[model samples]
Target chain A: MCVLAEEGYTGTADVKAFLAEHHGLALSDVDGHLYHHLNEEAIRHLFRVSSSLDSMVLGEPQILGQVKDAYGYASEFKSIGAVLDKFFSKAFSVAKRVRTETKVASSAVSISYAGVELARKIFGDLKDKTVMLIGAGEMCELAARHLLNAGVKGIMVTNRTYERAVKLAEEFDGTAIRFEEMVSHLKTADIVISSTGSPHFILKRDDVEEVIRIRRNRPMFFVDMAVPRDIDPDINDIDNVYVYDIDDLNNVIETNLEERQKEAGRAEEIVVTEVAAFRRWLDAQQVTPTIVSLRRKFDEIREAEVAKAMSMLGTDDPKTRKVVEALASSILNKVLHAPVTALKNDGNGRDPMELVAVVRELFDLTDGGKDCE
Target chain B: MQTLLLKSTTATYLVGALLYLYFIVTLKERGARLGRMFLLIGVVMHLFGFGMRFAEAGHTPITNLFESLSFFALVIVGAFLATELRYNLRVLGAFVAPLAFLFSLLSAFQKSELQSLNPALNSSWLPVHVIVLFIAYAFFAVQFAAGIMYLMQERQLKGKHLGAIFKRLPSLDVLDDINYRCLTIGFPLLTIGIITGSVWAQDAWGTYWSWDPKETASLATWLVYAALLHGRLTVGWRGRKAAIVAIVGFLLVVFTFLGINLLPAGKHTYASIAR
Candidate 1:
């Protein structure tokens, strides 16, 4: 029954540590019972749904799924209790609600998809476009998937690691080209998604310029979704080469964000409604312990009084003692009825805490005090 | 009544800006809370002001540059408030509030000449074009803020000097993601704005590709951002270099919005602040 609270931790690692340190709750502790009552409020607030913690990209929908997965893992381990279980279930519901109700989730599209969309804008139909994916990274895979889904005619994947490139190409039904042949393919590529993890530019300005010259200004869309960017910054200078680096994609991101923001407001309203509901449930929970204590106290008093009355009547007549015992039990039941009803009804109060306090005070239910004695 | 509300709201925002500055310089958590309170107050007041302006103007408070600029400032503030509420990015207030305050002050200083809508600007396309462009500009402004944070965080990481500022700022990855996200969202809006503006221009001026100074600067700004996005997505431009580019792109947006308007030779000369 130890309760501990701490200022919110910012980092994921820090949160994990905090949970472990304070609750003596390791990820391993998440048993079914614990999971059933998982500390979802803390999780939600820390993870950023309630506080919008998961929204670093501001309403991007991916993080909520990640959080759910984290909770699922915790639940699997049986570390969470009744509190955590209820909390997390509600959190999942909230996340789902937000996703459904909020424009927030809808407006902010992923950068990877933005790349493909941008390409589509330039080239009306991607069905005939040849997309060259340079550097077999995560972004490349994402962009490639989008392009393929858009019915791009062909895909050429090139990576410094030939084996990785080959694996990626195989999955996407794309051809694996050697990294050296990137510029060669660039001339033919209607759209290029460059996502290499290179420290330097993989495609130099001169190289892209040369490719553009060979292509004769037919409009090549380049999507650079890489860090330290795979394509040279200078390639934007080339005519008809519509190049969009990460920063340039802001315009698209903003429009999507605005749409998402609109959705988020709806989601937030849902969260607020859900939070109030959960609070009521919590309030009702408080009455349970009180009701249990009050019932135990009344039963003990009835038993003690009946024993004394039975002793007084038994010597004269066993039948009389039986009648007296029956009467006493009936009276006890009647006396206990109204208080129990009150306790139950008290939960419906606007401030249930006050009612709980009043009930506790009225019963003199001290933590260690025996009311019957 | 509306005019008074708007004036008071602008005053509140100015106060909020000061409080935010204090929060940044003092680096006190309480200061952050105080700053937020001020901002919230300012926003509430600004909303009142806007309502008043709408009531008095009998139109969308976006007809003249003065009203439009005021609306623009309000939109930026609204955008910031939304961002702050969602991300809990109070630190951004230090940078964003000042800009918002400056815009507000500029709006306040400008003559409130309630000119009749020009016949050319009378079309329905004007509001749509302007709204989209202004919103796009707001997003870019945020990108600029994120870029500044990115560079600072990068320097801190590289220098191994994780100070209070470093801790307060988001991680490098987060900053980069924010920058990317902002760009991705803003770019399309800008494109739409440009397209709509061109269409509107064609309706008014009988030509779409006039290459006016404002048009050219906007195109240039769009190109710069386009390049930045391409660099980040295709070329893998990120961290400090990407941040610098983002900052540079925002400057271009500023130039397109403010600087180009000041220049004498442009069809947008009427929209200029100078005259």
Candidate 2:
């Protein structure tokens, strides 16, 4: 749930114990196992996480950017090596492919979208309606943006701190009103979107009742996106007044989640295929050390054999010894060619580890292979 | 050779239209890219066809129904390509390419045997007048497509059940902006075309004012756009209302261009299929 900073570990228990010591918290032990992965499993996990398959708000786009930033920071500090480099880069690509090839992230998944959708139901078009936000909360700013994109005529912002309200209003290119004067300007808004931190209802029935009297009987929609709610629930009983809270907006978000879940199935398949491709590349890469050792062993044997034969034949002439060395290496190269090609190209998709084991036994290749370990 | 050129243009347009239609239907990004490529190719072929016809006839080639329809389709695809570049709106091509294909198809099937110009049609002003009107029709075609997309996007937004078409289409504001922009450009060109035709009529027929069906219908089209523009400026009438007017005006353009020829009375009858 929280970002781990500068924390690298080779095992799960170390991470758990570190968290417990740093934060004085303990994870429940009733579960079968706390999820953990290393190496390829870790790569697949990061790929799914970056692609938003593991996000609660399925198909949301922010997690990929966050993941990229994390990987970027880790690489900047020289903490990541070849394994993580390939894994994170491929994760970014898989995320991009899922984003473009599937309709996974097309639908907006926020409480803000629900507010805009509800306002649209009342006005049919937001092009002529005015929306007033009552707070400087993140929810208020986001809902205001959605309403603006839907073509609201104007926006009004009001906060207890007038300066903050003015700042938020400036961001939306909207007019800011003083908190005390919000009731007077309430009649100007056709859709009132409020997400304030107030403990009690900001727009009471009496205030709206008076505003309704000032204007004729035009309908007004109220979206209270705050926890503990900003608008009075009884306002729904008012004529032509609709009020929806966070839970009501959640229903809309849940429907959007279901839609994205259908698309996520295709996205997961893309991630899986990319993982398999990356695995093949990694397996081929693993064969490189054994190939290097095999060539080293063959060269050493050729040099030793040529020296022994030159003295045994009593041939000190450089031309005669040169012919012998060339003849010896040609047979070695021809023997190495087929096995090298099989390992490099992976033509039949044979198990690369088994092939490596065979080469190790056949040629007694061990020097450069041990260097790799 | 000219007939073959026209046929080839039609074939290219057919491919372009199918690609664009499939792009819209499937929301395929590659289809849009390839569709744009084919549409531009079709435009190039159409321009070559027009150039050949002009060379063959020794004049601007829109003297009859067959030639005029081909010219109209050419200007439409040409103007459509220019707008697509300006806006970077591939979806607009999806809505307009089919009209180009249909017109090109009709042009190919029509009697393409070149006719000696009826003496009444020999005025130099006739070519300029027809070309300007068709260019105006080209912008109107853009307006029609933009309006349809505006309504469709608006419906999708309001209905709250967006599908592939909604996602492929542009924003409602962009679509509305395109509609208004096309109207502003099309209306004045149409007015000038109408004025030029009246002058040509006066010189040829000895009268500047004739309430013939083509004249009347074009006048009606002009008035609709003019009123819409005026409302946009003075009363701020736009969006769905402006889109509807633009659509209605496009219908009037279609009618004045060809439907009036279907009627019994008009001096323009010899310029059409009845001859």
Candidate 3:
């Protein structure tokens, strides 16, 4: 089983050798083009995965949480080593930035939510408005739930079958009105949200006019969520009647999705910036351990020789001994300056790791102090 | 002391109005709170001013142009606050508070001298007629504001822009509800106010009906509101049409209060509002 843990595996040569020798795994080399396509080209794969950019559904939210859970599980298993520790944290931060700094998850991505958004625009506050459902079906029921979430004051359901209306209304904690009495009840409903699988139109212009008359021409919003709209399109001509069909609602959804995609672009930018920052920090740090050990080894040799010479001169001339010690330390510092400068600066922003490797080999420095946590 | 109180009240309302208009332009909801606070403070000061004047005069303190118009402004704020409490719509104040502020500003310029009530106008019904009528006017002002908001929201919805104001203002249903509520309450009060006015006129002038310009205008205003009420309930005549009616009715009320004096046949001039 070649369990290539792309997330937690840090790709150490020793670990790969051990896995191949002990687990009888073959080290299949990825061609240069494939490696670029997989790793270099999409180094922010963690970010994209967390933000659901890799998922079939564009900008889905659950993947981010799922990615977090997976990282948490890996952390619990003591599996993500030091290298992946930094990578996962950066990924989490990118995901959070994408969530907040952009509108990726703010707008509605579903038809039901689209209806609710339209309702919000027409009637600024839904907390006091009544929503009437002309018929109960899967879509109608879903829309009813969305309206409920929007804080509509009450819900009224009417259907060809009174029993079905009663059932739907009961499930939603609403009242069931007779389909025939929909006109009379229209006087009370500020929003008429309907989706019925009927062959013909259930409501007509004259019917709406009758309701408008009863309502004294107060504003009435009708959302036809069905293909064959339950309400007449011409009812919009009535003084306070506003009707929207399923296509209009779909258009709203499409617009909202486009907005989310735009926001996703911003999210990707943030991820790219963060990934580059993480990489720079990683590059700047790979030689930190060797440099620290080298400095330690030089200081120990200088201190040992100074202490031995001070004992030979004795405590009889403390000032003279101190001057000798200062001279000795100054010479040591002068001698180490050139090498330290070379190690610190590798021209044109090149990685200092190469210099550290050469210096470590020359000074016999060991990996004694890893700089990154 | 009365003059000082009226001036302070006007200042307070001015502040309130500025805050509300600021909210309208900026879409900052906190402006509504500050505006409401200023209006409430102004209302308190105005009532105190009226109280002190009433104590000094041994009457309702509505016997002069300054006193009457100032009282008119006060009642408008009071009615608006009542609706605010009922509906709890903070945005309502943003639309309606400025009118109260403007009215009070005009009242500040009104002649503030105290005057005794004329014997002809000293019937027990004096307070009933004037108070109810001014209150009716205030409700109509609120109705007018709601109507304007409804129209603006309608335009935004039709244009499909749904701008900041469209979102900040109450929905068309809500605005229409405000209009309906104000009308239902204002209509009956207006009817009663008119009836009381005629009774006072009958007692003072020995006639129940007159062709006085103010009287005719008041009747016209009443007829307009009555028709609106009738149309709303009987025929479902609401929304844009209802909003238009409220706006028209408010114009008539303004004319009944300010324009009736221009007529040569006017027995009741705007000054007579204080009578």
Candidate 4:
């Protein structure tokens, strides 16, 4: 819904008309749908979007990475010119600054992610670890999906209903164990996510202790998402086994969400400062072409006057001509210095385009017959 | 010149160790790279120093405590670099560099003067037996550091701390893998070291076995590693149990390598008793 278009106000009408024609809509209808903002506002909007300040989830990390990927594609396709390249790169840095300067993305906000975070803290790398699911509950499937995305090597699904277990295992490309055999196959799993309809604990401390011994004390993480708590609390006392029930994981997510809410306020302040800074850079960018043209104009006048003077003085000596040429350049630079300073300093307070227009008029810069910028 | 090179090596190692510690705390790649550079420089200088010491002493230069400790430090750094190159375990430098620095600092305090070779250590077997055993000890040192890291990480996981230290430390499996790797490498070298040592004993003392403190302690250390290797290969003994055993085995290695000299009990006590 957001579009970052470069150049000044002259291109806005053309963009609106182009959008209307492409989508086969009326001009008034397209104009109503297209809410346009100028350079500074567009930059602010992009910064907010990339920083996830505008997201429904205030500080989710995925939006920033998605923005980066979009920018990378634009770069690879060479669709963006210099201005948008500078703009998006600045937006990326602003997002990064917001991330690092605040605790926004540091905490887990979702329940499934909370489980994944805890698993990482225990197992570090989950790529080669297996997960075992005791039931086919939606919550357990969600958590397993998060773990799968986190690179868990495989998944094993089991249910009292053999057909249901097979269907769920096929969904995950994993094995299906009979509910009776799940405990026997538990030794192969590094993480056990259990959420069955059973009313009592399916696994106990003694069972896990025996499994840990058979596995020679490799660590195991168990997430009990069942309401009745499929894993026993006593199993947490085992040396390398960690058991977290739904309430425990919920507590983790709650604390993390509270932390993120506080950090979101700080992230907003960073976005505001960065938006203002980027606006200043954009303002400076407006004057660069003017400054280049102004410098070129001064150099042309300096060369013409220097040539005229050297011919009148009839200086055949190369040393005298070099000195005169150096003097001309020095004086031209001195003369151009004040106006150039005035143009660049416009970003601090005054409107930069006002100064740019004034310089262009005073120097007759547009007399070179460049129609539009 | 060798003494100067060795002193500079010590200073460089301290710098490298501090940089590696900084890298661990900050998780900065540049600090790790700079630390590796300094470690490389120290190893080269230490090698040159060893060559010069051998030339000046007219022997392998490990006949005394100073030379033995210095050489042990060098091999530890060398082994660490090789492991780091193979594993890309930059965070491990935080554990290893400081130990190398401590060893070099300890060697710096010892008498650096060339000592007359003990008559029993005068043969060519001196370098073969001592260097092989010291190399095994070097691998064990790396394993010990990994074991300590493993224990720290495992405690954090069991306790569910998940704090900054837990985040910085490597996983249990990776640390356990390093422990197994070091044990597999160190145990066989240890077996070979024992064999070569007994051969040297037969040539020098007219016996294939000696009940001297150093010889007995070395045998005990070798047996500990052998048992650990057996447990790992046969029963899949790993993680906390393996880390604990690795740590205990390194302690025994330390005792055999240096602590045995303090007891004043054997011909291997060349630096403490003979000197």
- Considering every candidate listed, which one attains the maximal DockQ? 3
Where model 4 places Cα greater than 4 Å from the true spot, the runs are: A1-45, A53-59, A65-86, A96-109, A117-128, A216-218, A247-277, A285-373, B273-275
Q: Report the lDDT tens digits of candidate 3 across residue range B104-208.
A: 776667667776667776778878888999999999999998899889887766544444565466667678889899998999999999899888888888898
Cα lDDT, all candidates: 0.70, 0.78, 0.76, 0.83
Model 4's chain B TM-score? 0.97
Taking the tens digit of each residue's C-alpha lDDT, what string does model 2 give over A237-265? Answer: 66556677777677656767777889988
Question: What is the number of backbone collisions in each predicted candidate, taken in the order shown?
Answer: 83, 0, 7, 0
DockQ of 3: 0.32
- Fraction of the true interface contacts (Cα pairs closer than 8 Å across chains) found in each model: 0.00, 0.00, 0.53, 0.42
What lDDT does candidate 1 reach at residue A291?
A: 83
Give the poorly placed runs of model 3, Cα more than 4 Å off.
Answer: A1-110, A120-145, A148-220, A225-232, A250-373, B56-58, B115-119, B122-124, B158-161, B270-275
CAPRI grade of model 1: incorrect
**Prediction 2 TM-score vs. true:** 0.74
lDDT of 1 by residue, B1-275 (tens): 66565656677777777777777776566777877777688777767777667666565567665666677677777777777776777788888877877777777776675566666667778768888988888878877887898777656433333344654566555566667877887899999999999988889999988998888999999999999888777756666677798899988987877787667767776555745
Clash pairs of candidate 4? none
How well does candidate 4 score on lDDT at residue A90?
83
